[model samples]
Every structure is written in C-alpha cells, then in structure tokens.
Target: MNSHKNASLTPRGREHLVKNIASQGARKAADAAGISTRTAARWKRRYQLEGVAGLRDRSSRPHRSPTRIGSDKTERIEGLRRNQRLGYAQIAERVGVSKSTVGRVCVKAGLAKLPPVQDSVPVRRYEKERPGELLHMDMKKLGCFDQPGHRVTGDRTRNTPRAGWQALHVAIDDHSRVGFSQVLRDETSHSACDFLIAALRYYRKLGVPIQAVMTDNGSAYKSRRFAKLLRRLGIKHKRTRPYTPRTNGKAERFIQTLLREWAYAYRYPSSDVRAAELQPWMQHYNFSRPHSAVSHKPPAFRLGFDGNNVLRNYT
Candidate 1:
C-alpha cells in the first residue's frame, strides 16, 4: 500500500517500531525489554501526534508500482542472471523484456551488480622483511610512438626516434614497495639479467645488498648464467609458479603502474621515440615519485640496511 524508499531499516528504527507495536498489543512485554525511558516517550509522542505511519520513515517513491512486473517475469530475470552471467541487456533480450525490467529485477533480487573482487589476503607474497632482502622482477612491452604522415607511427608499437613502446623490466622490494626498472628493446633473458645486474648495482650504491631475488618462471630467470650469477652474489633464488603473476605481485603492480602513468599517460610519435623517453621517466619514478604503499615516502627511504638485518618488513 505504501511506497518504497530505503527498504533497509536500522536496528534502532526496528526497535522503535517494535516498541510502538507492543505498546498497543502488549505494554508489559515492551517495558520488560528495557526500552529506554527517553525512546519510549518519543515513540508515544510520535504515535499520538502522527499515528502509526508517523513512527515510520516516509517513502519518497511514488504511491503505486506503475511498472509493476509480474512475479514470474522477475523470477525469470533472476534465473538468467544466476544461471549465466548475463548482463542487463542480454537478459532483457533473452527474456523478451525491456532493459529496465531486468535492471529492476536484479536490484530486487539483491544481486544488482557484482562487487569488485579484491582478495583480502594480498596475493603479493612476501619474500623478505627489508628493502634489500628480496626483490621481485617482471617485464612488460609497450608500443612505439606515433609520427605524422607515417602509418607506422599510427600504431603504438612503431619504432621511432623519440617515440615507441619498449619492454619494461621492473624489480621491486617486497616489503617496502621500493621499485627499480629498466627499459630495453626486447624482453630477452639477457635483457632481464642485465636489468638485474643494474638493479644490484643500484642497491649497492645505497649500501644495501640483496639477500634474495624472486622472479616468475621465465627462461631468462631459468638460465644457467642467471643461476650462477645469483650463486656468485651469494643471494638465494626463488621462482614463483608459472602463470601466477600475483605470487610476484609487486613487480606486476609496477607494470600496471607503468601502463597507467607513463606509457598510457600521453601519446608519443613512435616506438623509437617512446622507448627513448623511458630513461628520464624511470629516473623520475625511482627518485622523485612518492609511493602510497610506503606511506607517501620515496623508495630511497628503505635503502642502506645494515648487513646484520636481513629483512625490512615482515608480515
């Protein structure tokens, strides 16, 4: 009979309504439930002044369901949604109904839209406690720059002097979210190892020795030379499962960041041109950019750990 606004009522509202109902039906039971004196008096006043409807929240909706859908039709919409992940348009098409009907049905079913899926336990596995303790590595490829009057430049991957997409090899500290990266022509194993060498040197400049290195199951990381290099450096080597990028999520996130911020930020002329721009961009990212994961602190803050301490963050 009444319209619907926010169907969801709070416990306080429910208690007030329950008390009002009991006062009319069973006053003795309402008093026994320890209904506060102030709340009871207010309920009594609302009932007397505005009657039963005054004690309830007013609905802003229209008085009648003008587009009242049949029970069978609403049930049909929900069935399509649960059986198949059909979108509103698709469901409407299948059910031979209007798009709004499917939307309204979904809302009534309490399955309007799926919430964003974020794992409570962050899949970015911890390798070590400190910044230098463990580092995760990954690679991403971007297109080249776009140049005028050049069809090749029209494509994001075209090679150019100032613009082009290049492979980004990133290394990140698991605990501190400190990141290091290198841009190169290809994602070859040699390139990965070279990036690692440079990353090691970069940390060494800060007096931090990498205790361990972690990477995905890539041929570059699986090379004999890479293994020997790790042994020579006296650092343990760990590889995450194949295709499980989240196991090494820090590096993956760095790649996602690169996509969101630099490569996808603005359009360049060509791949060669875009590739060339990477060095300066990396310099700014590593030294200047403040990371939210590290409390708005730069990665440099986690550098220069004492040899006695192996890890910087643990959890």
Candidate 2:
C-alpha cells in the first residue's frame, strides 16, 4: 500500500499509535493520532493478536474473487488470440465474456498485438568500398505554401490554390552517406541537370571524385540532357529496375530523413523561410550528426578529414 503525503498512519506511525494506545485509552490515542476511534481500535486489536506483522501493510486484493475469469477461460482467450488472431470483441462474443475481460487476458498472455509477418526473401544489403564510388540521386515533391498550412494552423479554410509545387533534388554518397540537396522550381530535365552539376561541384570541392550515379527511371533522369551531362563529365549513370525504387534505396531513405527532419519538421510561415533553413541543416547533418552506417561517426569522417581540417573548413 502506498502511503499518501497526508496519510495519518504509515507502518511506523501505526506502531507508534499502537504503543500510545497501550499507554492511553483507544479514544485518546485516536485523538492524538488524528484518526477515527474505530480505526485506532481496529489497529489495537490487530497489534494485540498478531504483533508488529499486523501493523505492516497488507495486500488490498480480496482473499477470493468469484467474479474473476477462470484459468480455463483465460487460456481459451489467449489461444483464440494467438491461433485465430481474433480481436477482443470477437473473442468476448465467442467466450461469453466482456470485451474488457478478453483484453485483460490477452495483455497478461502477451498477445495484445499480432507479430508482423516475416518476409520470404532475405534483404540484399551492399555498401561501396570508397567515397564517390557511387552516388544515389532522387527527387521528392513538396507543396508550396504562403502561410502555415492546415497541419500547423488547424484551419483548413485558408487554402492556397496556386501555391505551386517544388522539387527537392537530393544526392547522397553511398560510402560516406554525405548528402547534398536543393529545392528547385520544378522537376524538369533542365533543373535535374543543373542540380546534378551543383552537387558534383560540391563533392569536387570536398575532394570526392564521382565515379557513377544511380537514380530511378523518372522522366527527368531519363532525359537526353541528363545522360549527355553524365557522359560529358565521364561519370557513369545507373538507373533502377522498372518499378523497383529500392534499387536506389540510399537516395530514397535520404529523402525520407529530409522530410521528417527538415521539410515538415517545422511549421514555417512560408516556403522561402523553410528553404532558407535547409543549408544550415545540411551543414549540421554532414559535419555534426552521426551516421549509423559509418559506425556512428559523422559523414565527413568517412571522407578521411582530420579533426582540425573538418572544424576549419566545414564548421
């Protein structure tokens, strides 16, 4: 039994009250202890019969409960949950018990939720041996907003019909997990080519020479301009299999993180305000945040940058 802050009697206080009862009368002891006379008398009788053990707290559970479900019913509920995957209401209807009872039984048996089915095919995971061996590129589309959307303001009445759409082009190094991203006006072939050039330039400044690039078979990526740009730079281009986005999983995962940690992560007054925060966020991601794939070290560490050089250049 947990004693409340204003509880008149704890186990120790009960013992003290019992001693006071022995010296004074029950009424006087109850008055001194600030408890009812009947309560004091009951404790005095328990102390007389069972000593200090009686003064200690006891379980509040009743000695027997006729209304509780039996072990057989509990077993039936759990078996239904595990074997038939029946919900609480279904099990209750079958077992002639309340839904809450079935729920309780399921919780106690650790069958509250069904386990996720395992995939038949084992995941084929791979990594590059060196920085710039392969770069993953992808684009994520985001809606433009003039003010906080319904998600932030909770007012669906204010809608911007011609708010337009922006494409977020992202490129991440397969080996280092170093990411470069930009929000552009559209997802056209020209914009894709320009973003790729900017990304390649950024990697070149970091001394990571690009060898190949991987992207999904989107219209912009399949454009002649994008292919010619790669050929001119002497960088090979690899496209994911038809309808297989996971083949270019690194860029896909990077876009997911970008959305969760940056794009919708905050409620900005306008798209421009959100765009302005991306550069600083990217700097933090590249230099400060630890990458689990690279042994919990920052992405810059994989590029072989010493502590001083990283702080001096990237910081």
Candidate 3:
C-alpha cells in the first residue's frame, strides 16, 4: 500500500510544482509566475506518466557561452609580444592586463623567449674622422721562451722561468689604420717617448700633422718624461679613462690582430728569435694583409703609404 501511495512534495520541488499547477494552461500566467509553459506541460505530462522525478532541472546550463576570450585575444597577445618584446609583467603594465592574463594569452599564442648574443670585442670604436689626426698607442707583452734549452712554440710554456719581451709600442692612425710598431725590452716612459718620436717621424714622412696621441693610463704613459716628450714634440697627449681599454679602440684592435696572426702563429726557442720573428710578420701585415674595415684594402693602400719596397699585395 505504501509503494502504491503517491508522496507529497519537497518544500523546493513542491514550490515548483505548485507554481506550475497554479498557472495551469495559461502561458502568460506561467511566465509571470516564473514557470515556462513547456515546463508546466512537462510536469503534467510526467504526472500523467512517471511522477515528481522529471520536475528536476536536466542539466543546469544551456549548451554555450559566447563570453570566453576567443582567437582574437590570442592574436592580440602575439601581436603585442612581437611588436614590443615585453615580458609578462611589462606587457601587463603596458597593455592594461593582468600578468596571468598575459601569460595565458602568450601560451595560447605559442610565444618563446629569445636568448642574448655574446659580446667579446677587445676594442670599442670611438668616432674619428681623419687619418693621422688621432693616433692610438699601446704595448703588448708576449712571452719569449728564451729560457736556456727550453723549446717554445707560441703560447706553449714550460713551468720554468720565462724571458719575455714587449712588443714595443704600437701606434695606429684612427682613420687610415696605418700602424707603427717595434719590439722593445720593456714598457717604460723612455720606451714610449721613443715610440712617440718614431711615430712623429713617420707622420712627418707622410707630411701630415698629427693632432693628438691617445693611449692607456699606464704608469709608463702617465709619467712626466712622457709628458715632456709630448711637449717637446709639440704633439698633444691624451690618456684613456681609468681602466677603460675600449677608449683606445684602434690600438686594442691592432693588438688583437697581432695576437691572432703573428704572436701565436709560430714558436720561438728564445726571446731574440721571437723578436726577430715579429719584423717579418709586421712587414706582411702592413704590406700584404687586406684590412676588412677599409674596403678590404691593405692599410698601406688606404693610408696612401706607397711602399715601393713592399713585397706582396694581400688582396
């Protein structure tokens, strides 16, 4: 008998059923009472057939929501990153979006972070217009493996003592790229003054008045003797900023060139042999080597140094 008996309604379910019952078949009344005619019909149909079970919502939501961020938002995120290359925080700040939004958008856009490049240049170029106007000078000390009975072949060293020599002082014309160098026993003011005198002589040979000479802030260069030498020659002397090698770009670059091509090119058993080796290499570099910066022409050609005695054309 209990199974056969139909039960009364739940407070909520009963409210729903009672509303449908009150509306009956009137569409306007059903709508005004927060019940759809279809729902009322469904309840009646179910009462005639199954019962209260069909009164419940089938699945709460309709099929679709048009409010989601679409393909357009993804494209926008990619466009922002491509144009500005901003990170999530920066992109959020600039575009007036949340960092999480930016991140999600970027993820949808298939964006990736770019790695940085290497910067290993020994020389940093400063602007200089004319040849012989600003000359840069520096000294490079290469090991001279002239230690008795020790075989030395370019940077290969024994744990024994070393007899090294200074690649005297080299001076390069900022515009012409013309260079002057001599192998010296040490880096001293006297050595620098000697190099300066030779440089002046070389420029004088070219009939060009050198405006100034720039060099590193080495003690040998900053000494009073070097100052007096410059005063005597009536040539201006300029020192680079403290600890700044790039301030004298040409000199530093030439030093790099010398190391790559000549200093490490071969091995010498003694200091004298190393120094002797340098002259031929310098001759080749000055006369035969085609400089890349100056239209791939040799410095001698670019600077108007007509060496009738030059042995080769490094075209």
* Winner by lDDT: 2
Residue-level lDDT tens digits of model 1 in 1-315: 353575333435545555655665435434544555556566656777877666676556888886677888888889888767689999998888899878887997887885445546554434466667788888887645445324424654534465544678888777766677777877777787788899998767656778888898888889888888889888899998887777887888888887777766666654566567766776556555787766676565555332233344210
Query: Where is model 1 poorest over a 10-residue stretch in terms of lDDT?
Result: 306-315
Q: Any idea what lDDT model 1 has?
A: 0.70
Give all TM-scores, in the order shown.
0.58, 0.70, 0.56
The models' CA-based lDDT, in order, is 0.70, 0.90, 0.70
lDDT of 3 at 248: 84
* Model 2: worst 10 consecutive residues (lDDT sum): 306-315
Residue-wise C-alpha lDDT for candidate 2, range 29-59, written one tens digit per residue:
9999999999999998899899999988788
State how far residue 233 of model 3 sits from its true place (Å): 0.9
Alpha carbon lDDT at 4, candidate 3: 16
TM-score of 3: 0.56
- Candidate with better TM-score, 1 vs 3: 1
Model 3: colliding residue pairs = 153-267
Q: Candidate 3, 238: how far from true, in Å?
A: 1.6
